[model samples]
Target: MEQWKKNLAVLWVGQFLVMAGMTMIIPFLSLYLQTDLGLSDPHETATWAGIIFAGNFVTSFLFQPLWGKLSDRYGRKMMLLRSGFGMAIVMVLMGFAQNPWHLLLLRMVNGTISGFNPASVSLISATTPKERMGFAMGTLQSGGIAGTILGPFIGGLLADAIGFRPIFYVTGLLLFLASLLAMFVVKESFDRTKAAAKPNVSIIQGFASLSRIPQLKSLFAVTFLIQFAMIGPMPLMPLYVQELHGTAVNLAFWSGLVGSAAGLSNMVSSPLLGRLSDRIGQERILLVSLIGSALLFIPQAMAGSVWQLLVLRFLQGVFLGGLIPSVNALIRKHTPDGMESRSFSFNSSTLSLGNMIGPIVGGVISGWIGIEGVFITSAVLFVLNALWVNRTLLAHRKQRQG
Candidate 1:
């Protein structure tokens, strides 16, 4: 295989490991907080879980651009190593946490060093051919989605077998192994001398330069909105499952199945949509996905059974599979040469921003109007994003035709 192809394969595994480690806690976070950490009050436990979960994203959003600037100055591979190793250590430390506050602090620190996803995206963007950007991004996304789909299932088994704390140790070890793979296998052609020769721009300057590009600016906005809408229902999903399935013997298992359903279809569909985008255009795939996903969310909000919700979520994943790959490919297409890494970094920050804010908003919406309201809110946001993309991007089609 060619070098870019080789990078994609190795980085695909790297993405899987990183994402799995990150997502493995999703299924049993409350269990860990309540059972392992000795929290008695249900409301306090829920609040703590939300805090611990959101803390990582809060720091990650603030720090990603800084890392991106550093990657532009150093190299993408080194940044990957930095994140991989740092996250590995943090994951291990979480297993040893004596209390909720300890775990919360460690999570905050983990966010400070989180950039593996963006670093990998930068490496792939730099190396892959422009014509195959969509396919490359989609395939890369599939690895993470696969991990996300499997993490909770595996985590549940492990939690039952070895217990909750051990899960963190295993996850951390896998991340370390992933880092080792990246350190030895992945190669990049960064030249520090040339990077130094270029006038060094401050991190803010770097962000400013990219923001000034109209297409990049618009793409960034759409990326944020997309994440906001998609993730808005996540924090409340287990409760929604409970509301649908009711308190039962297998409540946890059913919730895990519901959570993994969307990821399964997303993993199956991402690469296919990406290839189609490569042939036709990313804009077209993105438009259809935005509209389709918007419509799909409505049925999910109105789903009468857990099975119905599962099926709706799976289809929702099928439509949204094209979303991120298209966004990344569009960024790669619009970014100035030599600045791809920074552009991806900014894009990653928006993603982190969505991750941070989406759950909070979802939590508030779920509290105010109930869990179903969160899905309705997500549907509305998706429709608005579709309109935004149509207004901003499709207008270019007319200009090109004229």
Candidate 2:
């Protein structure tokens, strides 16, 4: 197999472990807070859990660009190892946390060091043959989504089997194993001498430079909105399930199924759609995906049963699979040489921003317009993003052709 293919295969495992480790602890966080941290008040436990959970994204959102710029200057593999090792230590310490504050601080620090995904992306984007970039991105995405889809289920079972504190230790060990795998297996041909010789651009300047590209600016919005629309409705899913199910016996199971249904299809479709994009054009795949996802969201709002919602979400995932891989491929196509990592990093920042803000905005919107309305709102956002893609990407292509 080619070196790029080898890197993708190794990093695919690394990405899966990293994402799984990160998410595996989530299912039992509240339980840990209550039992271990002794936060008996339901309100306090809930609030602490929310803050502790958001803490990672908060720091991750602020620091990703800095890491990106550093990766460009140094090397993506170094950054990848840095994040993996750093997060491993943090996850271990969380198992030893004596209070909510300890966990929160460590979670924030974990976020501060988190760059495994973007670093892997930068490395893969840098090494993969340009013609095959879409398929690579899609395949890589499937790894993360697969991890995400399975992490909670596995975590829930393990939390019951081994208890909460030990789970963190297991998560840490998994991360360490992932780092060790990458250190020995993944190969990068990054030329640090050439990277260092390039004019040093500050993170702010780098952001400004990337932002100047018309297509990139639009793509950034697409990245943000894709995450925003998908994640915004997530928190309300259980409540919506209850509304639809009306005293069903396995409400939690149905809710979990609903939540994960999209991811199941997303993991399966990303590589397929990515290959399709490479043939038809990334812009075309992106536009059709945005529109398809938007139209599907409208039906989800009207879903009469949990099963209905589950099917719609699974179909929507097919379209969701196309969005990010195409976006990443386009970002790679448009980003100037030497700034690839920084550009991908900045895009990662927008992704983290969307993750951070989506839930809050979704909750606020749900309060105003109800759960179904949140789906409509997400639909509208996707529709607007499709228009943005049409104006910026598709139209640009036509202009160049004409």
Candidate 3:
């Protein structure tokens, strides 16, 4: 009925499509490198797979803030179209790579052009009422989570049915269709006169200005930590699954289920927690989620069975799903008006940073302390983040009261 609601619906589909297209390659990536790219060595294939996979996040991290700042000057819907179409082209091109190097280069470029998620968040935050920010962000998160949960499962089926290269073609086609639809459907209202009146600040200056705010600065740290801790253990999940499932033939199926467990629960709970955060306060939600997530990780590290690990991970998602929506809401609450896009872009950059570094850190930690240690490491990070967030919120309360 409302314009904001319309934007949310359109962007929700767009996010789902974009995330699905991006993640669909995950299940078969190493296999593709080995089978399609003609890599003979298992070690080389694994190395190349890790490189190509991390490549996107590396470039995306560097560019997201730039895109976000530009969106503030221009508009979020425009940025969305740019990212959507650009990614569509890249996704299709990925299917055409003749070697690991070519595919790696193409993946890097995909990262450089990636801004759809940040742009969508900025668009929704700008359009939705502040009171509904949590619910809107939460619902928006569920779309991507659902896509993430289902993408690999669907990709695995398609890979078997049609093959890997064709799967990329299908994913690219779906993403392209989404972008074309958004060209007509997605809408945003901006105060151009105000935008024109606003001084033209360089990206660095714009970033500096936003990060100068104390609350925003703290929030940014929380974002980085959340992502770092949450994703750091991801690269180890398959090996961990193998360790638990030992000598099982259906390792792929179990690994896929384990990988999707958190996302499935997150998709189911993000909106509910988000709505609750809207009423109860996002800060409280963030605090409880951090602690609950930390505690959940402990059981995961100790789980003796694959099913036990899956159950713990699912429960972890129930609370951890609240963290991002609340963090995004707090960023909106603390950031100055008219700069929401840049702030969110910065948030996206931190997320990308976590994605990029988390795996590397997990690998190194796993080497030294082993897989279970990675969970302990993640739990420690979560606890530290919770403490920082709790202390920051307390100071804000005191500052307001005083």
lDDT of 2: 0.93
Please list the C-alpha lDDT of all candidates, in the order they appear: 0.88, 0.93, 0.88
Index of the highest-lDDT prediction: 2
Per-model TM-score, in order, reads: 0.94, 0.99, 0.96
**Candidate 2 TM-score versus the reference:** 0.99
RMSD in order of candidates: 1.9, 0.9, 1.5
Which ten contiguous residues of candidate 2 have the minimum total lDDT?
17-26
lDDT of 3 by residue, 86-168 (tens): 98888889999999999999999999999999899988888899889999999999999888777877888899999999987
Better of 2 and 3 by TM-score: 2
- Which residue pairs clash in candidate 1? none
Q: Compared with the true structure, what per-residue lDDT tens digits does model 1 show for residues 1-402?
A: 888898999889988988888778876899999888989899999889889988888898999888988898899999999999999999999999989999999999999999999999999988889888889999999998988777767887899899999999999998999889889888899998898788888888988888888778888998898899888898688889998998878887788788878888999889999999999888888889999998998988888999999999889899989899998998888898778788998999899899878887998988899888988898888888888778777777567769
Cα lDDT of model 2 by residue, 1-402, tens digit: 998999999888888888888788778999999999989999999999999999999999999999999999999999999999999999999999999999999999999999998999999999999889899999999999999989999999999999999988998998899899889988888899999999999999999999999999999889999999899999899999999999869988998999999999999999999998888889999999999999999999999988899999999999999999999999999999988889988999999999999999999999998999999999999999999999999999889889
